[model samples]
Target: MRDLIKDAIADLKKGDGFIYVTADGSKIDLHDAASKGIAVTPVNPKNQVIKKLEAAGLHLNDGKFLNELNELISLVTGNGVTSKTSKRRTFSDAEKSKIVEEWKKVEAAGKKTKAAFAREIGVGYQTFINWLRG
Candidate 1:
């Protein structure tokens, strides 16, 4: 892991972005070393630097470097990186028909489109349109 960090620093110095590989062989772009505050100026890759980078790449491929980096980032930023997830909503056929009927009533009463009625009823315009399509 230390070797990987060192290589990452060297890579950053050379204006090259570090590519982190996971145990599953997925590649993630970690940007440059400067962005991670590991190094600043570009440096020529010497024998020592090359060896360090190769070690780092191995650690990255094994998934150790990424976990450590994530932990470090969470410690510094106060929040760990995470993906967002949302629950899917399901509507019944009867509910869809009722909503379409209500939309028609709103349209009869001077509402320009079903979008306004959808907003009043708390459904998204696209969702309402999809319901209408059925």
Candidate 2:
């Protein structure tokens, strides 16, 4: 019954002409002279067809109904997630100063003919001198 009324409404709109429907045992023409659409007023207020059409029209006009329909669509047709991990580390300023001080000692020793100190620290002599200046 609902689908029939839905189709009838669509057809009436497409045809854009008078559609005769029995309203409470009386024949009446809906949208008698409309150019773009049809409008039918059923006489029996409690008729099932009239109730269904009214309900459908009300649901179509409601903002909350549209929001709920959108939510249902998103639930049924959503995409999956992807990874979002970072790959970097942070160090404190104190830690950096300690490392620089250790390098400066080896560099100062390497300059005073203890070239083996720089080699033992696994740093080039020039690199050690650069570290000592900081």
Candidate 3:
């Protein structure tokens, strides 16, 4: 049983899917194993399907096995881990000083709060505060 489970995991790692046959002869398809939906089953501690998969290191939540499966899928599909990359804006020292000076003027005039000023200048409130601190 352990060997079977290990072999299944190995196959998944090699970008191949398998169908697990339960002791009762029911079939559980592990196609697209990287997907959470593919691993859904009733939370029964004695469910052979779930038990075997869990024993093989597959967890419903994010876990090492799932990560491996995802990596394999990414390699096979040519869609590596999808991450959102934001373009960071860098301000020069002169630009920073100028913005700070303008903020000071606004502060003296009591026209707008720092958060509003930050919004007006297209920066986050926390980022603006950090700039001011610097």
Q: Which is the leading candidate under lDDT?
A: 3
lDDT of 3 by residue, 19-122 (tens): 45444555455453334354433222324445666766665333345546666787789985544442467889899889999899889999898887876665
lDDT of the candidates, in the order given: 0.58, 0.49, 0.63
Model 2 per-residue lDDT tens digits across residues 1-134: 56766764664454434334443444344545244244444443224444555566634323345545555665678733222332333435675467577656655766533344444443456654555475
In candidate 2, which residue pairs get closer than 3 Å at backbone N, Cα or C atoms, i.e. clash?
none
Task: Please list the residue runs of candidate 1 whose C-alpha ends up more than 4 Å from where it truly belongs after superposition.
Answer: 1-88
- Higher-TM-score candidate among 1 and 2? 1
In TM-score terms, candidate 1 sits at: 0.32
lDDT tens readout by residue for model 1, 21-107: 434544334454436544333233443445665654533322345556566787788885543332356778898898788677667
Clashing pairs in 3: none
Regions of candidate 2 where Cα sits further than 4 Å from its true position: 1-12, 25-58, 79-134
TM-scores vs. true structure, each candidate: 0.32, 0.28, 0.35
Question: For candidate 2, what is the TM-score?
Answer: 0.28
Model 3 scores a TM of 0.35
Badly placed stretches (over 4 Å) of model 3 are 1-86
